[model samples]
Target: MRPFLFLGVRPEDAPADDEYDAMLRCTGLDESTLRRVRLEAAPLGVVDLDAWSGIVVGGGPFCVSDPEDDKSAVQRRVEADLSRLLDAVVPADKPFFGACYGIGTLGRHQGGVVDRAHPEPVGAVTVELTAAGRADPVLGVAPPRFGAFVGHKESLSVLPAHAVLLASSPTAPVQAFRVGRHVYATQFHPELDADGLATRVEAYRFDGYFDPTEAADVVAAARTSGVRTVPPVLRAFVERHLHPRTDSGSGRGVLRDEIGAAQG
Candidate 1:
């Protein structure tokens, strides 16, 4: 079976590694099954969609709402790479999940209005599922309402015409949405746990998501928030796409047996 690809944009080592680990924990995938690539460190190059079971993108300090002149060379390159990847992913309806920064990337690609109008502070928020969300294959696994960790400089002010709104919060109208059938993007971090969020609070404290002095308070609040239901959405994405049985030849049965043994 092909491994799932995780595209990370955090330039810092600690937070980037932590983000990858958090994703692995949430998705129930080991290092072997979940491969990570730091886009900030290098170019995305050529990505073969068929080489992976699915793709998952993590958040970073970059903001889509930043003025074109304000974007660094790295930011510009990363955006270009993501746009190129989406060109292929959207047309084929490939299995893709993006969180935080992803909403901006996918939204922009789909003609959505992404801006700072809905900037959410670094903390937990109540995410209410839309009627469409409750029926979504991946998001339906989550409860109708749950706590989710969010901290972003921008959000989807207007959803793409072709996208279906899945979840929303009081502060951010477009908490989550789906493009085509398999592509998804969420404003909240589904791969984050309380501890993981705390780490980010410290890492991005001075990055303008919140007051630098409020970093400790943000961490404290995150620790106490009931944000456990979100990770299931990430796990569901993996389960929905990672089909070991789809592999060729004897490896198919062997891989299935390995998975069964691991589960047992």
Candidate 2:
């Protein structure tokens, strides 16, 4: 059972502990198996690869598109650190699942353009599988079409040359993608459901997603509409790609939380 390392940066509003608890509930990773890296408070080190089965980066309010002068010192350090990490990961084709902010990090590492061109409102969307996506070894286990929850101010304006787009929505052309073999990313929150997102809406109301006055409406809308059914995608990512790959440089980091439940 390999452990899944969860790297997070938001502390003021979205605490890593709470988010980890929710993810444990969603992904079924136990308490001891998920490690947290508070990238905001500390620098990321290459040694981090020594301890986890795979890496899972969560969403945050950090803006990768901010001007270099406007970028906080912490953000700068994290970006640099992640860049170094991806150098090891991209070549090895490690099993990594990045949501939201992960897209910008991974995209930036690969020389792709990431910005606010394809912003999507916070809510549900119908994800359509491209022909390649339909046959994608990792994503094919998911249904051809299903709704997913997404809220992003920025996206990969142009995918990296070596990247392949997996899932798309009318509003966002690259909802999901793959780099080489095992590296996967989504603009949506695969770890989030309505209940989890409600907590975020309440915490991030004034930050950006919505006006403070509209927080109630946002939560209410989430409750009423519910989350789109795309658990299979998340499950599939964990199962097919994250497990049984022993050749990766980051392989055997935890070996405790290796994903189970294979697709038929």
Task: Give the residue spans of candidate 1 off by over 4 A.
Answer: 228-231, 244-264
Give the candidate number with the greatest lDDT.
Answer: 1
In terms of lDDT, the poorest run of 10 residues in model 1 is: 247-256
Clashing pairs in 2: 1-255, 1-256, 1-257, 2-254, 2-255, 2-256, 2-257, 3-254, 52-253, 53-254
lDDT of 2 by residue, 1-264 (tens): 767788887765454566777667656577677677778888887745555677878888886887899888888898887778888888887778788899888988888899889998777777777776777765665556666677778888888899989888888888888898879888877777677777777677777877789878877776667453345555555655445544323221232133222111
RMSD of each: 6.1, 5.4
lDDT of 1: 0.85
Candidate 1 residues 1-264, lDDT tens each? Answer: 899999999998889999999999888899999999999999999999999899999999998778999999999999999999999999999999999999999999999999989889888898898988877777776666778889888999999998999999999999999998789999999887778887888887778878898888888887777554363778777887874223222222222332332212
